[model samples]
Target: MTSLPLVFDAPKRALPPRHLADLDAAGRRAAVAELGLPAYRADQLARHYFGRLTADVDTMTDLPAAARGELAALLPPLVTPVLEQSCDGGATRKTLWRAHDGTRAESVLMGYPDRATVCVSSQAGCGMACPFCATGQGGLQRNLSTAEIVEQVRQAAAAARDGALGEPARLSNVVFMGMGEPLANYPRVIAAVRRITEAVPDGLGISARGVTVSTVGLVPAIDRLADEGLPVTLAVSLHTPDDELRDTLVPVNNRWKVDEVLAAARRYAQATGRRVSIEYALIRDVNDQPWRADLLGTVLRREIGARLVHVNLIPLNPTPGSRWDASPRRVQDEFVRRVQAAGVACTVRDTRGREIAAACGQLAATGA
Candidate 1:
């Protein structure tokens, strides 16, 4: 049996010092004013951070040298790169970032033919305690501040624009599918989502539809997010369709069963008119059975309907020495067929960055 960390249900730790991303336009002005700086400097700083995508204080030549130092001190850096590894001939890159308190998290940048996506962590470690997840095994370190979450996206966007992942491209998509259960750190994650999707000179300006926030069926959070008016996709990590198996795979299922989760997802889809993504990690002999796939398809179709739900069949990316392994291609194919046959849309996810410990918490674990 796995030993769960005591911090699983503990309250969130104190957030780190305020960073620029934590504030909106008005808040930025207030922050600058508090620092004895001109209010207009706030917009300049915002432009540098969000529009220019540069965090280096020395590069802000528009500001006076002394003012730049003072402004930089006010808006301190949130994430320091600890390690970065690339795979898929540089198309997929993973970065390990160390926060102010020394807690570490990771983010992944993947460049596809049409889109560049960055998967960012919302917490230093995860409390979900999903047995097969690297992040979950480590347990919760602490929730990341809104700025800490936003910094990951900023860094990834910079990398994408710099051609770090082949030809220069804009970061077109962001996914909260790294390190932690995003909805677990609800407020901060939502703020970060706003920061990512808001228009430029104010935020990253990425479209809300291009962003995805995944959770392990945090039902209340799902319902709350549906009302936020952000049409970002909601991905429920439903590794198994049955409550009994799901209870073991996603411990949160103990509180809200499979049906409750799918119901909440249905509400979200109906509210946003965006199809909910059902994430099913196909662990060999665990939750990859054909019958389970059939159940998954039936339940999703019955609850959320075919138009409002899509299944993303993930091949389990086993951690080092983990008991879990990916289901064979034969099994995986059959599972996809079963779900599709039930009149549901399903596709195998394009796995990436496994060789470089791209999965959340893997880099931090190895570093520790």
Candidate 2:
């Protein structure tokens, strides 16, 4: 077995000041008390930020003028919009955000007839170093603070309510699949998840089951999330089925291997009773062979069982100047056929925002 080097250090950068979204109810009360305001003020702040989805102190009319400003100063803004691009007739919008530290990250909002989903980044640039991905090729910038992550959702939720994506609909789903390896920023991502799923006046009130947290097979983090008792869906980006190829496609495969990742995913499925999502990007002639598809079906069924897993076949959205491209339609159909033939559920994922570079593996926000 060949050893693969792992790099976990994100560039040391100053994170933004703590915001109201970062702290829980208790912490928020403590923070308010420290500012010489009554602890009950924390609940008012929470109602404005989480329930009203407004961070502007002026909109919080229930609070006294002086107290509102003092509390707002303590929370501090985290995300500043750098650029926003929309496609699919304004049904899909991608926003590039510059954090207070000047690190850039992207969050995408996509609206379907039934639900609206936002894809958010947990880190600025990714450290995973997946050769085919635009974000991974850029290298790590820094982990996003919990408040920074939650702010993206708040903005998206507000956008949805404001009819930014067609009719006024609720932002119902969130996927941590934008620019970075989510589990690498474990603690903050978990905290953000709580803030996203908690009920109104405390957090975004999005259902935990509607949230999906993706990883490039971060084994330990997957196990840790399983123990957290939050029933968010787990998505493993297993670009290839065999270890030999996965080690090259998803470099983290070199550390945990394909078997280890599937086992951890199986444990997550059993613990959460939620079907694990296997994300396979079908790059042209790269790990898209018929045999690889067969192997994918075999291994998934063997390790995680057919009932507990579903494969999300992603048609590769090639980055600019990258040799990688999407597989041919016939090839993609055959691959799906093979996986389904193995008695495991599989479907081609709906590709969106390609014109605005918001598709899978295209979210590189370093320059935005």
Candidate 3:
């Protein structure tokens, strides 16, 4: 008789203590009460962290000295930078962060004339397993807690305010396009989104519209996010239009397929009245052909039709030892021309941070 399939359980580590940043206002109040502190203490902490954008705890002079230590212990630093390397004359900085458990993640801060943006990771590593992506190659370590994710933005915001990027400009935008798939870490990412978009003395007070969350077509999660009413831009990473190639490029395609993803994008647009962004990574001789770009436009136009969908074409930044390479300039331009010819907006992404291992998984390779 054939033996049954073997069962092997993966070992699980003890999850870290939940931080106040991970909790909403009500939840924070509940946690403070559970910690034997008065409910108003939660509001005080929120004001210090969210309003003042400081979490040193020493600055929280409102709390008694005796109680400060306990509160600080409970709200210990969630994301500590191991090393910070910058290129472009410090205009672009990439940070390697060590979490409470020493699991490493990376975020990039880019300064622009109009606005500054921070690209934060949603998971410790990625599980998408896109052969061309550096982060995907590492596989997923674990989902980062909401606080860990938000703290990256918080620090970047603080840096921007402190003139880290030439002149002070607030962190005007945030993108979840770092190491891991944002949708894969849905719970924490959603919580982080709430903490980011809510009004201050509770959140960073950034407009919900400034936040962009990219997903590799997790349809159910996409649909659920539409109902959230936060009005954040939803970017769908559609590497290729045809299912056969996408099946290999994005393995999740086998389950949800292209039509389903576009349909979900439609749902998101309808719900939030926000434009849905299509992210296509143009790889040489792989996905950058003129015909594929035309097809992408056709599908997006037909499926979602003038419902505010734009495409951001990224030149594939192949990791070390990877076979993929960025598309040539001629091919890249032709692809953009074809997509725009078909009546859908498309543009190449501004390349940044290539000098200092700009790709997500690169920094952790040498050392965490």
Candidate 4:
């Protein structure tokens, strides 16, 4: 099959200023030295930002006034919340963030009884052109900077700490299943993940296992990520098990077929020992057929092994005016049954923020 004519690169746009989140330990120290500060000041700054979860230079009273002002330039705000919508009794909050360049991205913070999770965007918009997704239909804008991505998590974690989600829980999990195809903006996403999972003061200090990065089957990127040695979960958005329908549903399938994508996921699972999550959006009269469900189990079992994989079946969150709707409850149940009948683990995803458009681009669209 011919490759997709799609250009994975984002459109040209001016980027935001560099921030401390954009720098590694050594890089942060180098930056401080350029400002005539000692190298250890970088560690202090990190402790304030990543550890204490504050960017206000005023709150960093540990530093002399002059040094605080001098170091503050590198911490210029990257993401500003333009609007926020909440549902599920304030347990789920979605923020529409506008970058310094005025480009839009989004993040969602969901609170559970035991843990809180933040879903962050790696790009402002998407180029995947998945007909069922609001972000995909909106098309691509520019990619977010590394700090832009990290700030989303840092802010969400701080919000959770401050009881923005109620009951004051720690933000333990992060999923790159937000507005953009995370793997599309590969480098920044990986760097942001490192900054997120590293120890406090050095990074967010969250465990790497708490992080999950999803892709719509970018074959080469998947193989590359397997070698990163970061044990983050790999989630594959395999909306369909067959190529004929997938080529239409997920345009990238034109370039890499179902088997190719599954093989890459299998490789990642072997490399990381993390169970691969196959994300399938069950849409009515679309990919939710009984046979397709069985085929999904069979294909995943054959390609990625039943033991190393889990099926996360999502009820399609239809966009406004979209023709698509979620499958009936009975159909969804039967589909799950068939997949499980094939000896594969399958379950419906506990969808959050459905009333406020939990799908990534929906809030950004309204905020626009």
**Highest-lDDT candidate:** 4
Candidate 1 error regions (>4 Å):
1-12
- lDDT by residue (tens digit), candidate 1, 260-287: 9999999999999999999989999988
Model 3 misplaced stretches (Cα beyond 4 Å): 1-12
lDDT of 2 by residue, 69-129 (tens): 8998766878989788899999999998887876788999999999999999999889999
Candidates in order, TM-scores: namely: 0.96, 0.97, 0.95, 0.98
Per-residue lDDT of model 3, residues 91-207, tens digit only = 899999998788889999999999999999988888778888888888778888889998998899999999989898899899999988888777778899989988886788888
Model 4 C-alpha lDDT versus the unseen true structure: 0.92
lDDT tens digits, residue span 95-184, model 4: 999888788999999999989999999998899999999999999998999999999999999999999997888999999999999888
| lDDT (C-alpha) at residue 349 in model 1 | 95
Error of 3 at 103 (Å): 0.7
The lowest-lDDT stretch of 10 consecutive residues in candidate 2 is 1-10
TM-score of 1: 0.96
Best by TM-score: 4
Residue pairs in steric clash, candidate 3? none
Model 4 residue runs over 4 Å out of place are 1-6
